[model samples]
Target chain A: MGELRLMKGNEAIAEAAIRAGCDGYFGYPITPQSEILEYLMAEKPYEKTGMVVLQAESEVASINMVYGGAGAGKMVMTTSSSPGVSLMQEGISYIAGAELPALLVNINRGGPGLGTIQPSQADYWQSTKGGGHGDYHLLVLAPASVQEMSDFVKLGFDLAFKYRNPVIIHSDGAIGQMMEKVVLFDPIPRRTDDEIKKQCPWATVGKTPDRKRSIITSLELDPGKQEQVNLRLQAKYRKMEAEEVRYEEIACDDAEYIFVAFGTSARICQKSIELARAKGYKVGLFRPITLYPFPVNPLRELSTKIKGILVVEMNAGQMIEDVKLAVSCSLKVEHYGRFGGIIPTPEEVTENLISKVIGG
Target chain B: MTEEIIIAGFGGQGVLSMGKILAYSGVMQNKEVSWMPSYGPEMRGGTANVTVIISDERISSPILNAYDTAIILNQQSLDKFESKVKPGGMLIFDPNGITRLPARKDITIYSIAAADEAGKLGILKVFNMIVLGGFLKLKPLVAPEFIHKGLEKSLPARHHKLIPDNEKAIEVGKDLIQPFTPAD
Candidate 1:
């Protein structure tokens, strides 16, 4: 373990990206997540690790900068909130189509055109099911705590490079604004030019004298070739689904009822689980760590053992669709959520579960 | 034992910083701690608040509907958080901005002249530390030594020289607490 410090999640993401040897960070300042860029600018990582930190004029330019940097085989990233993320969707689609490896963080606020700056999980469908155009998938990781906020940056980058895909850290204002004690990892050195050239042979890092020039693009004028490309992307997504289904089961053993949630909602559900259990109700929490992979197997298996699964979110029933697909209607699957940035309290969640799921 | 506290006041009054310092002090003692603030527009010198949780074991949630302690610095905070404190919990307030006393029979209420003491000390910035000192004197979850260390760790190096004045304000605040004993 390295030094332990109490830091906010947004600030921790900035520090962790620097420590992870990220080559570049391009982002516009947005509420709830502006601290990420602010911390990076204050630290001046360029002085220490020679990392480039640029405040783009807009989220569109910022994500395109990520595309340009990542195409050159550099570990680049961008951060934004919901409205800003909506602006970056076009650039994100282009990055995904080009199969560029980069990290995109969404410190989610309430959505649908600048709804509010309060915390929300309404971007579940946008993050996991492809916020951008085309039939594609982003590797999404939901971090519930400040510690996980720091830890997931490295993990997101590693998985991005491993799969040659864009990875999204699906965080919300609750996790981004909250402060907790986190043990940061030891600094990892940036990948050298030689390493980048060897690992990402498809990188457009100027033509080599001995080899053919590498062209980084997503354009396929021929319809058949585009179909083939889509198939390849689908195969890659399947491989990810099979290999990277991550989740956490809290008190799931011998549970009669379970709450399915992710990101900030999962932490809220943890408290609800405690309250319900205190009232002699056998409740547990099934938290999906990787939102994209969805962790269908464990949920499918648990559906048989528990009486029912209640999907709780900060949105009005998005992940419930995924949970329903996972359970296949073997047991009752219901959703209870508070929309428009209204986070449901533990007592409310417990009361709703008792009246809605348990009573029904 | 776990202590969940809500500290609320005007944004410039260091409401969030007080919670942060207490959380840092808890971390210094190797305890699990979390600090969550009411961010965004609500923090623009309006009513701002933060929830700080310190526990011997891992803290399950940082958000809570009720808290064991409520440290209120303004009348709006008093009106908002007076009922949020659990029964048998403690409610500490600075009487400078409050026109009415905290009205609750189940919870214990105490008044600290934090703003006035800071005014007397000729530094308005030490008001939060004074209230923090009152809380620490009453609860003693983290020691004064750890709080001093927490000040060193939480403050920027450029502002570290002001720690002594803040310490003096805290000491003054420790001596000026007026416990509001409820009539039986």
Candidate 2:
């Protein structure tokens, strides 16, 4: 209800985690995303809000802390850039297998090695598909602004718990480092411990006198039990597909050409839309909010109406393959982007769109 | 809804600070905004740049390839990005920073001697504010007052004493930009 205040994208994520009533935050310091840890350090919401923030020695330890806390059915979160997130793959896969409701944020940077500090959306496939080898997916929410960086924590937790799964907030250096005005929540979050407890009865802090001991583990050695667990997970994913698929169709209603992009890349695509529109090209953008349960059905439908689909990413056409799989080979698809810390500009995309699709 | 921009220069030349201030102004305007910096080891006293996206709506993405316009404090950044400047976009530069402006026919380039201006003002720390002031004076997407308030809020409380000097620095920066000339 108060006037909005300006905040950095990293600080925004920290605030959102606390506001989401997440009981704990475990993270290590990494540029672009370090402010998340710093914000938590400065705010220290522990005594007042019953939240715990720990700066782990490494990203691996941080995620295991998240695993430990989330296993007790407490709202928990951890964050890192691409390399650190890479270290967290094993934990993430374990969390997914255990069907735990937790959140992780990857403020992506350029990679293959310690590439550069600039923002890059190169972690697309790693986050959407399995970074850790297995048949699992993180409900990845891609944000283009600081507000989403803050708000997605709440949404991630809500959906994660709703589906009994782990969710990934896949942002990049752009979203993490940027500053924006955000209407921040009050000192205390809207949710309470009792509220979270009521929703998650399986939460294991210390068992009540009347209840039996609860064990949180992903291990199912028996073949039959593993199959049953996999089936249960598949069912949960099916439910998410049926009910939780989210995306935005910008100017696509009457569009002749569609540009598919997400996270920071999608923001540039909007600028491309403006440029293309001026050039008399009926260009539109399809931004996938959830990268995991990708808006496949809608993309397939759009393929039928659009002449071409241009998928722009920071990496070398990683997500383009997903778009192709979703829409099949009916429409001509192309990749227009950059890699290794180079950000693709609207002018470059505009040139590509005009030359390839607008009959240049 | 984003009013996107690029500010590029050598690392210590206060390039990131300009983007930070613009991003702060976006916050004061109550617009959804984000700031992204070159990640990894690019900050090792090298050609540093930042992109800021300020918008009114739930900004669809913070990532952009081309800027609406850009401000170059050094030649390396200009050389790196000048050709990629949009056909009709603006470029604010420091004469001390660049030997030659891009020869693009349609684009408008406003050259400022921000580094020298800061040196003359006896407030060198406000070098970034000078260009920020140029941004406001030339074509302010957000109100100047909003940015003024943003500076007050963004700077640390201990540095609040420097507010007057910084504001004055912006005022000086505003005077440096040549008023727009109409195309005959």
Candidate 3:
């Protein structure tokens, strides 16, 4: 708990990174998320904490910079929107393969290509299903509130380092641009190089005479060794699934029907739940705070009682597949979504739920 | 109780800032609040709007359909938001640049020459503050004292000197409001 102030989600992300003791930030500005870079430059956390903040020439260059920084055992981060994140996929895969802990944020905008600047949850599959080229997973955290947008920065970094894996904070334009009251935490000290070396022994700091040189690379030319690496990564993901499946179940104890959503869609579903309940429908909400380690077991258990599960998203049903798989088709699962930056109102979500889930 | 409001005007009319101030005022009063603006290129010179909610309980969606209050500063905003006000809700407009009057019969409508008042005061930037005053006069969801505190929070310290003139514009706006009477 700390001082409360009204701030935008993007601005909160920048401040939280500073407070979280992040060592460096390399980013290229993009719409709806450019404020993150702007805030960092304006605040000049470099003077306060000696953190490095660089406006890279491009998204490709920025993510590579993050890889370079993370390889040195430094807590580094970068943020981009839809297309920019797409450009960072190759570097992200490299970082994941090297097991370099870093934080990546995608303040999503509408896109198959360079779509609208408005918000969209279309990046769900890109974030959770391994946007990069490899058998890898990013610990994806979806934040619905401006406060969660701030809080997840620290959480993502902690989890990233804990598992020696990259973490992604998947947010949308609505959450990124919207302003709300946020309680900021006290600043943490950036980890010194000795502490980083002690924790991340595999990190590529200058080779000392006391120990062997650690080469950071994804290239395991041997197929068997690569298979072993893949197995190890899978084991880590499985552990994450069992231990780190974060979700919120709202009024599900007596609910006959439930809406499953994440990020901004969860906020809209909260209102839909209220509207449905006012009309005497036993509706509740299930929000996945962690998108990658989907809350399969809890959802499967909840599906035993609920008659139907409606997945709502700001895209063309990206998360619905995960919801359906989580429930194992045990309960009737349906999806309601609005894509291409057309945000569905609570009334619209409510109407769709009544007609699709309740009536069907 | 919750007040879901939409304040819209042309870019640079301080529409979004008004919503931010109101939201900050709500926070100063220890209430839950959300302020969401229609961001992007539309904010340059076209119609701009912001949705603000202040409540005693936790707020849900920041994006909303109907609003408890609509404070429109121009004809474009009036045309866009006049229908979005909930029944028994309030619509406050500057009426300086608006061409068509609001035709809704179910809501309470009020007019204030906020832009003209700002002109008279020679501080054109306070026009949005004037309209904010009109909305607050009808529905003091956040108290004026909290609003003063909100101004302190919303504006950078360097521009704080304008707050008093903004406060004065608010008073002038309060005095200029004319409550609409329904015709039989």
Candidate 4:
């Protein structure tokens, strides 16, 4: 109980970033998520914690700025909506390929192109799967509450540095714009330059007399060397898959049906679980906290106990593919969603559970 | 107790800020709270609405289809949200520019001339506060002291001097609200 305050998810993320001792935040404003940059600017963490907050000319410039700062062994991050995130795909791939520890937040809005400015989880395929042209994956975290929106900033940074890989906090407009009560953590002091040099020996912190000069780039013209780079990246992703799967099971012990969802959809499904249970239907919710290294094993285990899974999302059905693969297509796995920025109600989810999963 | 509330009005009517103050009050009282607004282009001169849920338990969905209470300011909001209130719920509104009034027989209805009252008081900005006062009169979810704390926390410190004025408007609202019986 450090400090209790009512905050929007975007505001909470900005506060948490500053409290996490983040070194820099470079972002271009976008609807539903412009609050992140707005809040940061208003707070002026540059004066408070000596953090650097810059409004880049565009999303491409923001991502490149993030790359530059991260390469210098500074804790750096950027936030954008779906369209802006699309502009940063190549940069994200470059960061991933360079093994730079950076954090990215995608407060997704409805999108195939420049979709509506309302909440949508339509970026599941683009975020968890490789959005850019590369053999890579961003460790994606899906925060279901404003509390997690605050908490995951530190967690994302920790995970990013642990694996030396970029991490994405896959959020949506609903979570980004909605307000909730949150207890903030105490501020962790920003790391000193010497501390960063000691922590990130691979960082481009200028030529040191004690060690070889570190070059930070994704380019490897030689085919054999590029293959080795791909192999190393693949092994790191596998290691993440083995250890980093995170999820939550609510009333799952006795459930006959499970609702698989993340972020805002998971919040709705929790209410649906209560509604369905009152009607004598045994249902539960399985929320994946980490979307990239999805909670595949636990869901596979839960699949043996449940009758079916309704993969609810704000998207048409992006995450359902992963849900299908997780369970090996052993049971009925259906998708219930409201795309184009429409959020399905809890009653609709309960109705879908009754008609689609149980009856259908 | 879980109270799901919707506050709807035109963009400049302070609908979102009223909900924010209420949610902040809940936070002051150690309750779980969430405020989800219908944002984007609709918030610019168009109808704006926010769904606020204050509960003792962890709130599940910030987005909701129905609410236990609806605070409607305009005719458009009343037409849209009057039916969305749960049966035996509460509907509070400011009847300043309304042709068609609420006809719901299941839920209890109350009308407060907050806009008119604020205009008469020569403080039109406190119109939402008047409505909030009316709401507290019906269902005192948060204490007055906590509301003071809420305003202090939600509003910028530069605006702290106006807390008493807002509180006075709330009192005016508490007196002005009248229980409505539909004219069949």
Per-residue lDDT tens digits for candidate 1, residues A200-227, read: 9889887878556887888999999999
Query: B1-184, model 2: which lDDT tens digit per residue?
Result: 5576888888877777777777787777777666666644667788888877777776544555566788888888888877656778888888784566556566787877788888886778888888888887877777878877777777888989988888888888888986333234
Q: In angstroms, how far off is B30's CA in candidate 1?
A: 0.5
lDDT tens digits by residue: candidate 4, A1-360? 689889999999999999999999999999989999999999999998999999999999999999999999999999999999999999999999999999999999998899899999999999999899899999999999999999999999999999999999999999999999888999999999999999999989889798679999999999999999999999999999999999999989999999999999999998998899999999999999999998899999999999999999998888899899999999999999998899999999999989999999
* Residue pairs whose backbone atoms clash in candidate 3: none
TM-score list, all predictions:
0.98, 0.88, 0.98, 0.99
Q: For model 1, state the Cα shift of residue A130 in Å.
A: 1.0
Q: Native-contact fraction for each model?
A: 0.84, 0.72, 0.95, 0.86
Give one digit per residue, the lDDT tens place, for model 2 in A171-278. 988768766667766554635656656666777756777556777888889989999998988888888888888899999989999899987788888878887899
**Cα lDDT, all candidates:** 0.92, 0.81, 0.92, 0.94
Report DockQ per prediction, comma-separated.
0.88, 0.50, 0.93, 0.90
What lDDT is reached at residue B131 by model 2? 84
Please give the lDDT score for candidate 2. 0.81
Off by over 4 Å in 4: none
Worst 10 residues of 3 chain B by lDDT: B175-184
lDDT of 1 at A55: 96
For model 1, the superposed segments whose C-alpha errors exceed 4 Å read: B182-184
Candidate 3, residues A53-80, lDDT tens digits: the string is: 9999999999999999999989999999
Off by over 4 Å in 2: A1-3, A185-197, A354-360, B1-5, B26-36, B52-70, B81-92, B95-114, B140-144, B176-184
Better lDDT candidate (3, 4): 4
Ranking by DockQ: 3, 4, 1, 2
